[model samples]
Target: MKKTLLAAAALAFTAGLAHAGDTVRMGTEGKYPPYNFINDKGQVDGFERELGDKLCAMESLTCTWTTNDWDSIIPNLLSGNYDTIMAGMSITDERKKTIDFTQAYYPPAFSAYLGKDAGANIKGVVAAQVGTIQADYVAKSGATLLEFPTMDDTIAAVKNGEADAVFADKDALKPFSKAEGGDFVWAGQEVQLGEGIGVGLRKSDTALKDKLNDGIGKMKADGSLNVLLKKWFGDETPTF
Candidate 1:
């Protein structure tokens, strides 16, 4: 839910609805592990990839996937580069002002601190991915914020001692913290942000948005969404 200047043509395009059965393009940042990431085969693979496919099948929509850098994700959608954003985007009022969202597919999860240090230095330098909720939090917080273009860079900042800690979605950082022989550790209390993760769409694609919402509802009702959540995030991660 970040970045980009909307062109006038893009704003005008948002007034038109997409035709049914048109090929739907699913946009993602294929760098965030467990959410959307490029697999060994150089194809998008992750929880969202699986989830999006299921939703598409349920809705009977022809779907395709594409990757974009996180910073321009929303703008690309508004400009019609993609039909939906399946990136790990949260539902927030600030983001809602720019684009509409389908109902949440993932539940609200905590953002946590990771570092070599034992506890977080709240007022010290903290690293977060640029244009993320965590970055916005550190900016408003008393801490000095160190922004990076990617999630991996934020962890690198902590590793290289540029920041006291990296704050990010706890699930996104779990593999690092629990890695064998890794030095990173959970540094502080987990902070919750946003409502939950959802599929982002242009305000004009009300039809697609409705189809996605209905498919998500079906998943939730049948417990299939929870299965995906557990498969990616472990049972300890909350379910719908």
Candidate 2:
């Protein structure tokens, strides 16, 4: 009886160790500006990168970042290449089908941009980035759709008259428009497309999910999240 009790205690201790030291590999499309872009220094620098660093510190876990194309991020997560995703991904009902989301850390909304010479009559018809809620809205709202791999390409399509307008997140459009010599205009009111952005994790890892949620909540309560947001948006709070 004594031997059995000792062995049971040893097994429980091993299990606890396994849970405590687990590493989380996070994936993101490092090309989206103001969120997960690769800077000129050849390093990832953006709101999501900063936020992920904070979460890792709070959770007392080792975190790693890997870059992939935006379209492939979800599939890579499902295949277990990464434990979580922080690619400025919005929490939507459609995405919730495959992976679980942590508490939202950033707002999610869509804005439209038009070229200087584009007609206002083409205002309501525009293309949005593929695999986004903006694309879904365009499909349902009778807008013509032209998909692109990056926001820069989408904006260029409008500027060159290949497409009349482009729809994407406000954070993305704001910087692009300012840098491009004021060639684009924000059309209509910005659309609140979904809930805030969250970390995507595999459905089987409920323990890690809970850990991340707690860490994010702590970041918010301690003002770390706001600090990162201001670094990206400069006095504007991200809208969900």
- Residue-pair clashes per prediction, in order, are 0, 2
Candidate 1, residue 128: how far the Cα is off, in Å: 0.4
RMSD of each: 4.0, 7.1
Task: Give candidate 2 regions above 4 Å deviation.
Answer: 1-20, 117-125, 178-182
- What digit string (tens of lDDT, one per residue) describes model 2 on residues 5-86? 9986775454334335666777888878888988898887788888888788788888877888887888877766677888
| Winner by TM-score | 1
Off by over 4 Å in 1: 1-20, 179-181
Best candidate according to lDDT: 1
Which ten contiguous residues of candidate 2 have the minimum total lDDT?
Answer: 11-20
lDDT of 1 by residue, 100-155 (tens): 99999999889999888676585799999988998999899889999998899998
Give the whole-model CA lDDT for all candidates, comma-separated. Answer: 0.88, 0.76
Look at candidate 2 and give me any clashing residue pairs. 107-240, 108-240
RMSD of 2: 7.1
Structural similarity to truth (TM-score) of each candidate:
0.92, 0.85
In model 1, residue pairs whose N, Cα or C atoms come closer than 3 Å (at least 3 residues apart or on different chains), thus clashing, are: none
